[model samples]
Target: MKGKNKHNKLKPIMKKSMLAALSLGIALPVAGSLPHALAGAIEPTINISRPVLNDDIYWLSHSSEQVDALPIMPSMPIGVDNNTIIIDLSTHFSSDRFTQLGAISENTNVARAYVTNDNKLVVVPYRSGKINIQLQAKNALSPEGEMIRDNIELYISKKGDLNGDDKVDSADAVQLYNYLRNMVTRRGFSYVEKNQADVDRNGEPELADMNALLSGYANQSLGAKDNSYVLTFKQVDDAPYALNGKLNGDLKVGATLTSNIEFFDPDGDTPRSMLYQWYRGSEASGEGKTEIIGATEAVYKITAAEQEKYLFLQVTPQSYSSDRPQGNPVVLRSESTVAVKQEDIVSLSPSNGSTEVKTNAPLVITYNRPVKINMNSFSSIIIRNLTSNQIEANYIFFLGNNFRANDNKVIIDNPGLKYGANYSIEVSNDAIIAADPDDNAYMQGTVVEQNGVQWTFTTQIPQ
Candidate 1:
């Protein structure tokens, strides 16, 4: 059970390499029925054929020519010399199973495998390089569990062999760069294949990986370089605004706004990539905001609908410094207010001179632009019951009592007008009607005067 468990655990880890080896006919044979002489008087020995790289088989962006299997003689007698096998393999996994952290050949320095009791052999490469595959077995003439051993060598290519030409050069760097920039969408390469360009092993191929290749290609040519470096990225926050032109403050509807990051690299001298996202909301703050779709560029145009709304720009910076693999982008949010011409109630409830209104009906007011009101000054605005010669405060709501204010307009609960009463709601210039202070159209002491800002309505019979 222990052996079975270990095999199961290692099988998945070896699936990729195993598939390549199997396709190439290099996998070991099962020990189900060993040489007939094993149980006979003659001792049986195991002999394996040397594996040769075909080099003719090729696949998308890689060569499928790895030694897949080694022919073995299960019934051969002992005393035959075992041959040395050499496999020139690339670091790209035959299958994606090489995606694990320890699967890189440069890390493990060798491949590993074990001979199963059933005469089967399993191999897994820890890292690309000269790896040894050792097998153990015992002849029937010896103890029941006694065994002989042999080893095979596997030479893995260095990382950054992007083109699989067995060399790391400017070509690999160009491929990696184009891929990162999204220029090569159908490169016929799988995820693992592209990962080979992560020469610095920073989890992904970025600017630093390209730099590593360019910096180490000479050493690689000399057969002394591994194209490995400590992947590190410094933490970078949203950069300050460069204020290329004017930013923030008041922007009129239909006007254009442009801005960008100040462009300072935390690595002191390295260049970093930056992106932008624009948001729209009612407040200068980002709460209750929505991203402006397709608003990723630095320049933005204010729409008439955006009047009285706030536009916030968030800048994100990306870095591909090998020393900063764990580094994350920092975001900075800046804002501008869209100034709209002062707006007032473009429309009102209970149309002026309206009669037969329900005693309980609410007064609704709608505006072209959102407005602000100072409920404290409600007293100055009155609804007079002219039929009864009484102030609205005498029978209806008082200051701070029955009015609701929103961005665009206000709603007032029924003043409980007596049935058949004629009432006139008046607003002097002193009435507290104004656009929110945050709005561009906001003014101090006047309500919208479309119809002189006063209206009279008569209540229907009490129901």
Candidate 2:
């Protein structure tokens, strides 16, 4: 009876064991499949928030400015199941994986790109053009992750766009001028804007750049075709030469002469200043030329010393540019030889002989050309009273109080002439001298008379 009871207990225990085995077999398969499903749900993904991934990025850079670092990816979030994120640049990809990074330009002359330590892609553009950049993100969970690629089209522009409107205009030139002269506040330009300000492309935003920008703005206003804001550097300098030169004006003593010389520069350089010099030569062909002292003007006055000599002018074009400051000099000779004119009395204030003379009538004399009064012959000029046989007035006594002499005329104060009395005025030959004396003309106070009279006048008697 005891053996039968034990067998019953053993039977129950065996049934319980079989049930436990069947439950274990079903739970193991479900637990194993759960991990696979979780792995699929937790796959690594790269999220690019900045710059809108897969879109073409347009970047404009000024050639005069330097681009330090431009962030391509400012914010990049990686979603993974506690996996280490790894960022790789397309340039660093292996040969086998290059295709996965997408098409990239091999020419980086215009710009350069690189990946930052924080998985942010950065670009440095040197000039104008299009460039391509590729970025890939991977994790421990997904080693062969997808790439986030985009094309960067960089457009390089010349300097001088101070306002950064992209179009160079008069406003930009004005701004540059104000900035250079410190007429405005110290609102300095950025690296890129500064590059635009360097219109001359000399690596500096100087006065020359401002001038060039202004010129370009003017050309644009005039509807010029080649009115680009950027100035093309002149590689070689060509010296200026005279196309044609000629001298003008009367070639005589006390006359003014001018030069009409046209200059042409092969490089189209405008002269900053023109230098002029007057020379006196013996022959009209410019032989035995001698420079006239203090005759560095566009117009030269013929002097008495230059009479009977050829007058010529020499002009030199000058520029502020250091490349070529001075141009070839041009010499222009006068067409005719210089002549000296003789000094003669042009007119007298009073008639040569007249009655009814007043008591206080001054004497006046006029010359045809400029003449100088001889100080040594001051006493020789006198007004004598013929009726009284006495000298009425001496010119030396009134030399300063009532005597006045000028280029072509002289006046003497009267010293109480006798009313209704005959008077005779006599002037010494040495009293007047021509301003420009020559061997054949105005020889030592040789004054020619006008109307056959030197100077004799009658005034109203006791009006």
The sequence of per-residue lDDT tens digits that candidate 2 reaches over residues 129-155 is 334443333222223332323333333
Who wins the lDDT comparison?
2
Measured with C-alpha atoms, the lDDT of residue 435 in candidate 2 is 65
Error of 2 at 138 (Å): 73
Instruction: For candidate 1, write residues 1-463 as lDDT tens digits.
Output: 0000000010112224323323332222232221111111111211121111111112111112222321221111111123212222212121122111111122233444443333333334333344444332222231232222222233443455555444445455556555555422333433334345556554444445545555455444311233221111011222221112224434765345666444433222234555777788886656898888988877776666677777777665445444432223333344556666454446657776788888777776676666555544434556688899888653122455566667776666666778898887655433334454533332222233543445677888756
Model 2 weakest 10-residue run by lDDT = 1-10
Best by TM-score: 2
TM-score for candidate 1: 0.24
RMSD of 2: 31.9
Instruction: Give the whole-model CA lDDT for all candidates, comma-separated.
Output: 0.43, 0.48
